[model samples]
Target: MFARVVVTNMGNEMFNDGLFYTEQAELHKDQQFNKWRYCRSAIICFCVAAEAELAKLIAHSLRKQPHLSPEYTEILLFLTDPNSDKPIPKKLKNIRKKYNLLRRLNGLRPQKPDQRYMELTELRNKIIHYTFSSHEDVYAGTILDSTKIARDAVRDFIADLYSIVRETPPEWVNNNSSIDIQ
Candidate 1:
């Protein structure tokens, strides 16, 4: 009997969903209703996709370590082991924590995520916990820019992950196709 690894495909699915929403937004640009809805959905999907892909890369990096403490091994197994029964750490649920953890696991210095990642997260949070303030303006042009930023940021993260792991990215991961959003 051999150990089986389990990696979820949620990342790819979420990415595809984001692309779908982007396409829908472009297709329905002529409509008078729900012009921003698709853009909002796409931003959320892109953010989720980035988080899922980051977790996958971290798990992969952890598994490749030649000598890791039992604590880290436990985390790795929790992510990649099909039979793992270990409880995941609460902090690991946070995207920032996962990003730093990935860096540390790969023998890299942990630092704050870049501006693009920060922008994506901020946009995602604002949309997810929408609070309409009279002082804040939501312009169609700004929303379109945010949507583009979300897509580009996630694509950048995927490319960076592949570089960090020194692995060739899959076709889907490398396909940073631009959406023709107006």
Candidate 2:
């Protein structure tokens, strides 16, 4: 089991719906083109939820696959600007990736689902930099639903990856808590 933690940063770019972010009221606002900062953190209650639900997934994997000596954690941090290099720490150099800059501005993901995870993971290179934008959503539309499509892709990928583990043996002290109804 390979465990990883990911943080989603919300950029502060005003949309037609309202400012980049305003409180929970804006998110639930009923409008024709309702908009909210489509980042990864949704703060609610005394608890919080990933605006993207991607964190829950990483935790779920840790619980289900203890055999791989799994110990992983993640933080879904929100950002005010895509190019806000100020908040980024020196130690967390891995945060810079080409694909991430794109995801922040437009919802366009990597060309292939397999490269999605690391597509935005390589932009920190001093010699080669990833591009960021402060424009309207170029990849908007039904395809902003790219995340949903990616979810389906992940489900299918995991199904195949874990098939052998499930078949390793039924009596090997099974633990099914690691998986959720994807």
Candidate 3:
């Protein structure tokens, strides 16, 4: 008898959404209208997809360690969250913490988040916490550049995680090719 496994669709769906936003940003990269919007959205979606996938990986790893006591498991689940008073189910960890936990669970060596991950995270934060006044230039090309960085970051992040887990990444991660944005 073969073991049957069922997985949720949200992680992939979010990744695909990021791809869609990337496409939109590319299509409008040369235009002034909505290009910044699309680029910003693409960066945000990519970051979200990366975080969602990491969370899913941690959750799956948690499932494999059935020997852990319920209290210990809860502690592991919320390890990144500082507020211990919060309900276990409601606590959430930031992406870097989640990655660290995943590494610890797999007996991997500890390291800081890599450059690609930091670059993507910074891009996501820059756009997400938008300010009204800034000396930074606001243009379609500039925003599109950030979008491309985000696209590569998420792809690399996913590939690296899959490699750590000894699993093959999905087709989309490898299939991304540069298309003419104009």
Candidate 4:
């Protein structure tokens, strides 16, 4: 029997929402209106969703290992804050650190977040903390580029995990295509 892992759908939903916002922004731009506001928010939403999806994948994969199950449970508890007292942000940071450590122990190279992933994260932070005068100032093109990078990173990470779960390289790995959730 094949082991089944339930993947979260939130990432796909958020990505779709981001696309909708991008389309709206484009429409506004064509109509000679400011598009940056929506575009910036869209990118941030997409990044957040993608990160959630990636974290889910990592946690799911790690939990499958009998030896790591205990650690996985702790991480989940930290993330959920069942105690209702732990700072969620700090717990989230610790979870990311632990995830990286597990990735390294699993023999995956580039255990840390990918360069593009890190860049998108930083961009998301800047957008959230600072203000831009115009959509042009934020460089809509750059946001679009970061979106592609973020998507590719998620795809690659999923592909790698799928390969491990199947004990072989899945067809998507060779084809450079998205994994079919079925």
- Candidate number achieving the greatest lDDT relative to the actual structure: 1
Q: Tell me the tens digit of each residue's lDDT in model 4 across 10-52.
A: 6665665565666666667644334666567666766765566
How well does each candidate superpose onto the true structure, as a TM-score? 0.77, 0.25, 0.75, 0.61
lDDT of each: 0.73, 0.26, 0.68, 0.55
When 3 and 4 are scored with TM-score, the better candidate is 3
Off by over 4 Å in 4: 1-8, 31-33, 69-72, 80-84, 88-99, 131-182
Point to the candidate with the largest TM-score: 1
Ranking by lDDT: 1, 3, 4, 2
For candidate 2, the lDDT comes to 0.26
> Candidate 1 lDDT, tens digit per residue, 109-162?
877776797777877787777777511424355676677667778888777766
Question: What does the lDDT come to for candidate 3?
Answer: 0.68
lDDT of 2 by residue, 1-182 (tens): 99988653211111111112223224444432332223111111101111112222332343454342311211112122334445443222232232232232232343432343222112112112323441222223432233223233333333322332332211211221122211
| Model 2 TM-score (2 dp) | 0.25
Better of 1 and 4 by lDDT: 1
Superposed on all Cα atoms, the candidates' RMSDs to the truth, in angstroms, are: 5.6, 15.1, 6.7, 7.1
lDDT of 3 by residue, 30-129 (tens): 7756787787777777787777777767766667775766654785566445565657442244556667767766778756766887777876776667
